[model samples]
Target: MIEQTLLKCEEMIQRGSSSFYKAFAGLPSPRREAVHVIYAFCRMIDDSVDEPEESPYSIFELRSHFQNLDHAEGHFIWPALRWLFENFPQSSKDQFMLQMQGQVRDLSFTHYETMDQLESYCYLVAGTVGEMLLPVLRDDSNEEAQSAGIALGMGMQIVNIIRDVGEDLTRGRRYLPLEVMEKHGYTQQELERNVVNDRFIAVLQELKGAALDWFKEGLDNVHTYPPESGMAVELAAAFYAGILDDVAASGYDVFRRRAYVSDEAKLLMFRRTAARYPSPFGGKGAAAVH
Candidate 1:
């Protein structure tokens, strides 16, 4: 029954984000199912905050719902999440709390004054996801691998911020640090207007540079995971990094269009990453996995 529920969660993830599903494809079943459950939980929380009209519960009610997980009766997500917490109690609770805290911030905190503040927000929203998934990928005792996972999560969040500038502004949020914007002579007013000028481009370039540095630092230890898990992380990072490349290819005109990696490009990335890592479940690197 739990397996069936987890399969439903897997379908949710596949429908919501094909890129993430692509990354998860390389994992063996055990880790893959764990990841699906985690993703489903995160998706539930994110939707509760981001789309209140569609959500069954309000943010406060969502918190209450999760807090009462032991008594949760009808929902598939609660049972799936309960199973995860029962099996991996070490970090899942704290990580979920942190993720919720970040969502709360999203409700009230729309602007950032410094990079430090922005990074803290990123860690809460994305880093905790890394923390949650680390145990499933490998032993929970490996501190270094856990740290790398957090860093990689942060890098991915930063990439999201960089890519979604226009969309974020439309929603009345400015994720870029106010200081960085001022330093580049890009004002909030200009950003809200979706102005694509040289200064705005420079600001984006700086943000992208910072994101790439985090990606490099975070993914430096991809070999830490068992072959397939490592390849999954590496491939996901490569896909996110490819978005950076797309942004550049668009000449940093983020205000003009959303940037994305093509499915063909992702397949190529999978092949290259698989070649570099040499998967244990391999026929021909990622070709067989996909």
Candidate 2:
């Protein structure tokens, strides 16, 4: 029964983490399974918050699942995540933080009043995933590795916020920090208009700069990975960083259209990434460790 539960959980995670899973193909089987389990947990949390209909029910379901996982002994995903928590002495799993996000989602509290607030929100929903992943992938936990993972996670999340600005606004959600918008003299009305205004464009430019900085920070930390463990991280980071380039090419008109990298561009990125680091794991990939 536990095996069946884990398999079902794996299926759910694989579907939710299609973006992450593609990169995991480069991982060895054992490491790949850990990544899958991590993503499954993230998927469960995201579904609780993002599902448009029956989201209330989804939150309850996730809470129930976690309760069962904590008290019982047979669930596959539970034990896998539990093993990761137990094995990584330097790590901490803030289940309370995870539960808090479900509450935030339930309230549809997506808008932000300041960068600090946005940062806090990012840490909960995305950075926590990074913390979970680092312990699973790295042989030894390093503060540098954890910091880089958090930055990468935050950068990816900001990219998602930028991409979804329009849709989110339509859904009565706004993720752009109010401080950034007001600082630039932009308005929620302007966002709702979804026009290519100079003020709006400038706001996006500032946000993009911030995202790029985080990406560079994440890139710097990637070297801490012992080559093999770093492959998936490199792939996902490069993939998400490509979205920033997409936004740039669109002239920062994120309000008018959501920028997306083409499949060709992804293939080109994959090819370039593969050429630069032949082995997904360690070995020569470490030579680039500058």
Candidate 3:
């Protein structure tokens, strides 16, 4: 029954995000299942806002049930959460709540004003994910690793913003800070027009610089994580950072062409990760994991 229950989450992860599912799938059973559950629940939370038709519960209901998890029922997630906490009690309950809290912000905060505001939003939505995964990825945690985890999460969220600028606009949202645009001499009107010129590129470049800094900070102590987990983290970061290069290759026309890393590129990333760390499962190192 438990195996059947968690398989639902495995399916969810497979369907939701290839980079995530592929990166964590290699963890030995307990850790792999734990990552799947965490991602599936997070994906469900995001879907509740962006694709509510598909999610089982609304954000408010999710928050309510999550607050009362032991008695929570009516979904695969509750049982999955039970298994997760039962096995890995070190996972942060507060971080999970903050994740839901961030989604709640998506309801009213459709647009961003400044880099500061955007960073706060990123922390709510993505940084918390770092905190949530830290315990599961590593047995012992400290301030340094915790901070790096948050930095990585927030950095990845910034990449999402850079990649989804066009899609978000279609949905009446803009995450790029107005200050960023103004500083680069780009304007809201230009963004809405899908301009991909020097100033426009400059704006995203600014964000990219910051994102890279966060990625560096996040991975500063890569040696600290268990070897396989470290490799997985690097692979995840590579897949994400690779998208920026794809976006640039397309001349930064994020408005129409959605950037993606190809299978060949993903294989190369896996090889690079494997060379840096030893692992038992051994990466597929072939056929696009992303």
Task: Give the per-residue lDDT of model 1 (tens digit) for 175-247.
Answer: 9999999999998888877888899888888888888888787788877678887888887888899999999
Candidate 2 lDDT tens digits, 1-290: 53455466558656665556555556654566667767776665665666737443466665666666566343455676665455554545574356446346636576789999887777777777777777667778777878898888888888888877887777688888999999989988878888667888788878777887888888796766755666667778777877778877887767668676665676566566656564543344333221
Q: What is the Å distance of residue 170 in model 3 from its true position? A: 1.4
lDDT sort, best first: 3, 1, 2
- RMSD to the true structure for each prediction, in A, is 1.7, 4.5, 1.7
TM-score of each: 0.94, 0.82, 0.96
Ranking by TM-score: 3, 1, 2
Candidate 3: worst 10 consecutive residues by lDDT? Answer: 279-288
Better of 2 and 3 by TM-score: 3
State each candidate's clash count: 0, 4, 0
Candidate 2 global TM-score: 0.82
Model 2 clash tally, residue pairs? 4
Worst lDDT run of 10 residues, candidate 1, spans: 279-288
For model 3, residues 1-290, the per-residue Cα lDDT tens digits are: 99988999999988888878777755666888888899989998998998888788999999999999999999999999989999998876899889998989988888898999999999999999988888888999999999999999998999999999999999889999999898989989998889899999999999998889999999998799977678778888888899889988999999989898886887788877777664343544323254
lDDT of 2 at 198: 80
Off by over 4 Å in 1: 89-91, 284-289
Clashing pairs in 3: none
Model-by-model lDDT, in order?
A: 0.83, 0.69, 0.87
